[model samples]
Target chain A: MDRNIAGVTIQVNEEGYLTNFAQWNTAIGDALAAEADLALTPRHWEVLNYLQTEFKNDSPLSIRKIGKSGVVDIKEFYQLFPTAPLKTASKIAGIPKPASCI
Target chain B: MKRILILGAGTAGTMMANHLHKELSPNQWEIDIIDEQEEHYYQPGYLFLPFDIYEPEDIIKPIRDFIPHGVNLLIEKIDRIVPREQYVQMENGDRLRYDILIIATGTKIAPEETEGMQGEEWKKSVFDFYTFNGSLDLRNKLREWQGGRLVVHVTEMPIKCPVAPLEFAFLADSYFKNKHIRDKVEITYVTPLSGAFTKPKATTALQHLLDEKHIHVETDFAIERVDNENKMIVDYGGREIPFDLLVTVPTNKGDDLIARSGLGDDLNFVPTDKGTLQSKAWQNIFVLGDATNIAASKAVSVAHFEAEILTENIKRFIAGEPLNAEFDGHANCFVETGNGKALLIDFNYTHEPVEGTFPLPGVGPLRLLKESRLNHMGKLAFRWIYWNMLLKGTHIPFVSTHMQEAGKEFA
Candidate 1:
C-alpha cells in the first residue's frame, strides 16, 4: 500500500510501515517523520544512523546495545525522540519496525 | 426498600459488597451483587502463573465465600444495562431493577482488537498471560523451552496491572538463568512507550534495571499485524520483529455490556468523575477500577481507594445530602525486579513517585522507587492481605486512602 504525503507516494504496509527498505530515501524519511510531528535533528539522525548500522549487521536493537555502542545514552535517546526511541528511530532509519518488550 | 445493584464480584465489586453491606441498613436498602463467573481471580498473581510461582489453588476461590451474609449474590451473564429505565437485562431474560447501580465489570484483554493477533498461531506460538487458561498454556510452553528470541510485547496501553509486563520480563530473566539456559535466551522488552515506564522518574529507574539485565528495549513500535506463518509481529511502519516465543498483552477494554448500554468511551470505559468516582453521565450510577476512564492506573489499590470514597458518597447521595469525599487518583504497585527483590511506588493525581520512606515519616519498613528484599517480601505477603484484609473491607491500619507527602523527597 502507498500513502501519498504532500506529493510523495511512499509505499507502506497495512499498518503503515515501509514495505521496501531499498525504496526508502531521505525525502520519504522526512515526510514520514512529519506525519508523527517530529522534526529531524542532527542528534536524531545519529540515533537513526546507529539503528541502521546495527540492523544491517543483524544485531538486535536495544537501548543498552545502542548505549554500549557509544552513540547516545538512553536518556538522550528519549530526549531526541520523546515518545518511542526505538520505533521512531527505526522508522526514521528506514529499517524493519522494532518490536519491544517493555 | 431501595435496591443497590453491583455489576461484578471482582476485587472492586467484592470490596464494595462487603463495605456497603455493613454501612446500609438491611431494612433501608437491598444490596445485591451479580457476576457470571463462580470463581474470583487474584489478577496480580497471573504474572507468576507462567513461571509456576503460584498454583491455581492459591489464586482461585469461590465467589460466594466472600459476600457478606445479608447481601444477595446473583450468578448470571449481563446482557445490557437499561440505565434510563434503572434496570439491567440479563442473558437469562430476567430484568433487575436498581435504585442505585455500580459498574465494576472491569477491563479484559481483547486479542481480536489487533490484526491477526488471534490467528492460527494463537496459543501455539503467540500467547497472552492475562487469563487463567492463557497462563496455564504459557506455563506448559515455558516448561520445555530450550529458548530463542523470547519476545514480550504489549499491543496497547491502559492495561490492568501496568507494571506486570515489566515484572514478567524481570521474572523471565531470573527464570531462564535458574534453568541454566540464560545464555540461550535473548530477551527483548517491546512497548509503545518511549522508555521503561509511563512516569519519567520510574522510567529512568526501570531502564537502568533493564540495562543491568542485558535485556533489549524496543519503543514506539505500534503493532500493525501478527504474521503468524512467518513467526513475526509487524508494526504500523512495516517493521517486522521475529520471535521464537511471543508473549503479548493484548488490548484491554471494558465489558461489551458497557458499550451496548451506551455508557462507555471509544474503548468501552465509562467516563467517571476522577474525584468523586461517580458516573459523569448518570447521577445514580458509579464506576470503579478497570471500568472507568479515570486518569489512574487500573489497579486494585485505586479501586480500593475509589471504593472507600464512593461508598461514602453513595451514603451521602442516598440521604439527599452533599457528597464531599474525594479520591486523588492514588495508585500503589510493586515492581518485581527478579532475584527476590522488588520496588514499590506510591503516587496520586498530583504527585509522581519519588525517593521516599513509607508508612512512617523519615522511617519506613518499606522503600519507594528503589529495589530491596523487603519490597519483594511485601509483594509476596500481599496475597494474604488481598484475601484477609483488602477484600473484606477491613481498613489497613496505617496506609490511608489519601496519599501522604510527609516522607517523600521530590527530585
Candidate 2:
C-alpha cells in the first residue's frame, strides 16, 4: 500500500517497511524516523548508509553483521533505534526488514 | 573415466551418491563420497533424545550401510578443497581430483563462538540438543533433575532444524506435566527473532500453542554473553534472562574446511545460486543442504527435494545442457507440539506455510498448520521413511518435490 510521509506518497508494506527503495528519500526517511520518535543524528545516517549499501549489494542484514560492520556496534544500535532496533532501523532506512528464513 | 567427488556422506551427499550412481554408468564415470565420521545419524531424533523418547540406536547406523555398491565411501579427514585445481586435499597429504564436486558438508554447532557459553557450566548446567553427545547428556540431566527455571534459548538464526529448539520446549512442558512437576518448573523460550517463529501466519499459530502451553517468550533478544556467575544470558541491550538450566542452540556454521579453502561467507557458508544449487564462485562445484548460504530451511526434507532437482541438474550439466533452476526451497516439516499432537507445515521459497490439507490436498490424509493426532503419527512414521525411502532416494508417494498450492488457503 502507498503511505503518505513527509507530504509524499511512498510504497510500504503492512508493517510499514518500504517496499520500493526508489521512492525513498531523505524527507521520507526523516518522517519515518520522526514517527519512530528518533531524531536523525550523523551516527544514525552512517548506519543508514551502511544498511542502504548492504541492501544495494543484496546482502542480508543482521545485528551481528552490523556489529562487525565497524560503522556501529549492536549496543549503540539498540540505543539509537531503541526497541527492535533492526526492524525500526530498516523501516526508517526504507528497506525491507531482514527475513529470518524458516 | 571422469569422476564425481562428493564431500560429506550425510543425508544430502548420500542421496546424491545414490541418485548419480543409478544415472551414470559405472564404466564411464566414478563416484566417491568422503566423510570422516563413521556413523550416520538421524539428526531429527536429537529433539526426542532430550525427552527420552528416542534411543541412540534408533537414530544411528553405519555410514557404509547407505552408500551404494559402486560408489566409493572414503572415510578420510579433508584438509581443504583446491577449487581452481579441482581437487580435494586430505589431511594425510593425499589429494583427490574430480571432474565435478558436490559439497554437502552441512552445518555444525559452534558453542565456543559465544562468550562464556563453554565456560565452567558447559554441559553440566547449560546444554545443547543440536549434537548427539549434548542430547544424550541432556537426557541424563533431565532424568534426575528437580524442577526450576529452565531457559530454552537460541543464540542466533539459521540453526539446523530451527524448530527443534521450540519442539524441545514443548516436549519439556509435556515431560514436566507427566512427572507432575509442571507447576514447579518455569519454562521460558528465548529467541533472537521477533516472535515465536519467522513467518507471520505460522508464528500466530505457534504463538497460540505457546500461550496455551504457558511457555514464556522472550523475543528480539540478541544475546551478547552468558554470565556463568549470575546464571543468566545477557543481551546486547543489557536485558538479562536468568535460568537454573540453559538449553541453547549455539551459532551454527558450515564446516571449517570451507573457511580453510577461503570459499565461504562470514559464517563459513558457501554462497550458492539459490535456485540452481550451483556454487556462485565456481560452476563445476554444486552445493546443497546446510552447506550453502541459501534462503532455505536447513532441513533433511529440503535436501530431499533438492536432491531430486539437483540430480536432474547434474545430468544436465554432464550432458552439456543448461542447468535447471528448479530448486524452490521446498521444506516439509512436522512440528511436534507435544501431547501426541503435531502440525504439518509444507512451504517453499515464495510461499509461507498456511492452513491446508497436504499430499492428497482436499481429500485429506494430513492437515497442514493445524494440530492433530494424525500429524503426530506422521511425525513418528517419518523415522521409517527417513531410513528406508528418504535415504535411498526413493520418491515418497504422493508428495511432490515442489510446494503444492492447490489445497492451501493463501490470504
Candidate 3:
C-alpha cells in the first residue's frame, strides 16, 4: 500500500500493515497503527476518518463533533485520543517536530 | 551582622540576589542563595522554543553565571524554612541562619496530582512545556509529528504565566501552517478557566484571538485524569476531550519544601499580603514569583514589578523605616498572535487589558489589545532585557515598576 504526500512515503506489507513509514516520513495514520502495535481494527478507523477530514480541510476538527461522526463511541473517543496522536499526526504529516518536542 | 537568605536562583531569587548585593554593604551584611538546580532558564524563552525561534542553549545558562561574585551560592536541596527561628534547613544536614528570608522557591509541575497524568503516555502522547525537559521532549514529538487531534490542556489554575497555554495554541497554529501540514493538524485549546484568559476582559480579547486562529476552546473543564491506556482526558464534570495528542500544563504547586515548612495555603503557595508580598505568617519572610498566593498571573513581568516593590520594602525593613504601601499588582505581557504580530496587555489588580498604546501614549512602538508586528518584536527582544537588565536588578528606563495609566485608553 502507498499514501500520497510529498516527502512522506508510506509503504505497507501484504496484510496492509505498515512496513516502513520512516522516522521523517511517518504519517499520523501510520503512527496510530504503530501505537496500537499492529492491533488496529476498523474501530480505530474512526481516528483515521477524523484525521482525514482534519487534513483534507487543513483545520482543527472538533472533538465532540468528530466523536459523533459515527466512527467511535463518544465515551471511547475521548478515551483513545490524547495529545500524542495530534502531535504524531503533525509528524506523520511530515512537519518538523518543534524544538520543545526534542 | 544581618544575613539575608534567598531561596531558588530562578528569576525572582536571582533578581533579589542582584538587588540586595548592590544595596547592602558587604562589611555589614552577608548574602546567601540556595538552589539545587544548576541551570538558570530564561523561562519566557520557553514559549518561543517549541516554534524553533529559540535554541535550548539560548534559553539555558549555568545558574552560577547569573549569581554575582559577592553573594554566596549554595547549590543544595532545601529541607525546610524555620520562619520563626529565622533559619533554613538544608537537605545536607546543615542549617543557615538569616535575619531576613526571601522565599522564591517557585513552582513545579505535579502531574501525579491528577490521575493518569504521569502514566506511560507522558512525554509520548501527553506532554508539558513548563519544564525544560518537557519542552525538549515536546520538540522531538513535534518534529516527527504528522498531525491529528492536538488538545492543549491546562490542568488547573495558579500555573505559571497563565497565558502560556494559549500561546502554545497560537504558536502551534503558525508552526503547522508553515510546515504545509496545517491541514493535517487539528489544534484544540482546553482550559479550566472560562474563556481564553483568567480575567474577564482579557479573556474576551483572548477568546477573540483564539476564534480568529480557529483554535477551539473548551472552557470550565476541571480535568479528572489523563487515561493513558484510552488516551483521553476526563474532567470532573464528566466532560471528556479526545485527542490524538495531549499537551498538558499539569497541576502547578509551590515547592515541596513549602509543604515541609507548613507555610503555604491549600494550593501550597505562601499566604502573602496582596499589597506587601510579605508572608502573612512571618514578618521577616517575603514571597515572590510563582510561590505567592496572589491573584496575579505567574509571569516574569509580575515578578519584575514585585521585585521593585519588595526591594524597596526590604530596604525599609532593614533601616527600620516604614514600608511603602505600593505594588499595584502591575504585570505587563506580550501575547504572540503569530504571523509577525503580537498583542501587548498591561493591567493591575483592578483594571483589565484596555485598548491603547504602551511605553509612549500617542506614538508607542507597541500597541495594546490590537495586534502589531512591533509588539511581536518586543516579545522577542525581552529575553535580552530579562538577563542583562531585569535579573541584574538594574532599572529599565521607560518601564516603571508600577503600572502606568498614561497611555491606556479606557472604554
Q: First chain TM-score in every candidate? A: 0.84, 0.95, 0.41
Can you tell me the CAPRI class of model 1?
Answer: incorrect
Where does candidate 3 stray beyond 4 Å? A1-102, B198-200, B203-206
State which candidate, 1 or 2, has the greater DockQ.
Answer: 2
Evaluated at residue B67, the lDDT of candidate 2 is: 92
lDDT of 2 by residue, B83-193 (tens): 999999999999999999999999999988889999888888899999999999999999988999999998877789878888889999999999999998999999887
Ranking under lDDT, best-scoring first?
Answer: 2, 1, 3
- Model 3 per-residue lDDT tens digits across residues B58-148: 9988889888999999999999988888899888899999999999989999887788988899878989999988888888889899999
Best prediction by lDDT? 2
User: On residues B33-59, what C-alpha lDDT tens digit does candidate 1 reach at each position?
Assistant: 999999999988888889989998889
- As a TM-score, model 2 comes out at 0.96
DockQ-based CAPRI category assigned to the predicted complex of candidate 3: incorrect
**lDDT for each candidate structure:** 0.84, 0.90, 0.76
Q: After aligning candidate 1 to the native by TM-score, how far in Å is the CA of A89 from where it should be?
A: 16
User: Which ten contiguous residues of candidate 3 chain B have the minimum total lDDT?
Assistant: B192-201
